[model samples]
Target: MKARSFRFFAPFAFALSFSFLSAAPARAAGPDPDPWFGKDKALHFSVSAAIAAGGYGVGSAIFDARGHALLLGAGLGVLAGAGKEALDATGYGDPSWKDFTWDLIGVAAGLAVAWTVDLLVRGTGDTHPLFTAPAPGEMKSLGPSGLRVVF
Candidate 1:
């Protein structure tokens, strides 16, 4: 090929190559489009974590063992993460290993949290808010029902 002919196709070749290369990583990283800090990773993490927590709750309700619940939670987390990745690979979204990595992290965190709560509530299993109002009989009229404080 002559120099002039090659020169004519140089821009087109460059554009095509650039187009293909650009899609290597930035597939569907949400609005930011940054593969590293994309919202997709966050979504993956949350969804997997929720599924793990749900599994723990269900297993705990049905099984008599805490460890069994934890194990089932971990298994459900793994399955949910893999299912999410497989769904993404169907062209509905960009499939990313990084996203799945975050999902695993979320699963571990969720498991740890559920385990802690289970242990904490083992004896009483009573959950209550910090503040409690007195009954009508015990209610005091010593001061205003509501007070406004100025900063």
Candidate 2:
């Protein structure tokens, strides 16, 4: 039963991720033009880490297996990143392997961090960061200026 459900949920989750990637807005070049956009790399990192940690935690809990959870979390991260890149390649946004790679790294790092923290805490608590919704009127910049705005 668990195996069957795992298979079902995995694909469903991937599909949902793909849908989200397809729906993400294209990258714009500028100060985001949005007043609410926070031009902070820390925020992006935090968001990525939080999502990854959550993925790891949920995977761990559902599978009751660390290896399986790690694999699933990494696979999901890579798939989601690649899917997003593909969507961006459609001229709707910027398709960047760099971004995908970094995202994957972030996901892996987050998962590792969560696992380590969990172990250190002796499984008594979780250290997964809470996910936060982006604010409206957010804009992201693209390119070398290290400008990527999000709301």
Candidate 3:
């Protein structure tokens, strides 16, 4: 009986002691916080740009379409940003729409770069793999092309 009684009162005593521990008083209302330049925003942009470029490159290689690559990369980038914000909302950190906006902008810029490179690779009218002509003075025969495998 004594053991059982102690167990019940022991929890109550612990809870009562915890109730006595007080937190610091809240601060008086102040001016709105100023927006500052954040390094984290820069990192968010750069990392998103790199990831978007890679995603576009790989998607372009697999799909063989610039528009498809843009869609795939942008969609993924936005989804990733949204997911990150959602994770932040879980109380680990403060979430911001501005960060996601920067991500979207970076993704668009990176996808544009990927598209331009793809165009350069594909060339205007040539279907050949060779990006450039042999020389201005010499006429060269097209060499055998190798098979490309994409996954």
Candidate topping lDDT: 1
Runs with alpha carbons beyond 4 Å of true place in candidate 3? 1-36, 124-151
Candidate 3 whole-model C-alpha lDDT, 0 to 1 = 0.68
Task: For each candidate in the order shown, give its overall lDDT on alpha carbons.
Answer: 0.72, 0.61, 0.68
Ranking by TM-score: 3, 1, 2
Q: What is the lDDT of residue 120 in candidate 3?
A: 84
What is candidate 3's lDDT per residue for 1-151, written digit by digit as tens?
9999999899999887887764547679885342334767776677788778888877665554355567778888777878888888997777887777777877888877877787887754332222333233433332355444322
Cα lDDT tens digits for candidate 2, 14-61: 999999999989887785432222343344345556677877777655
Name the candidate, 2 or 3, with the larger lDDT value.
Answer: 3
Give the per-residue lDDT of model 1 (tens digit) for 1-151.
Answer: 6999999999999999999988787556466454766777788788888888889877665444565677889899989898878998998777888988988988988888876786677633222211222222432222355532211
Q: Compared to the true structure, candidate 2 yields what TM-score?
A: 0.48
Ranking by lDDT: 1, 3, 2
Q: Give the clashing residue pairs of candidate 1, or none.
A: none
- What are the candidates' C-alpha RMSDs? 18.0, 24.5, 13.6
Q: Residue 105's C-alpha lDDT in candidate 1?
A: 86
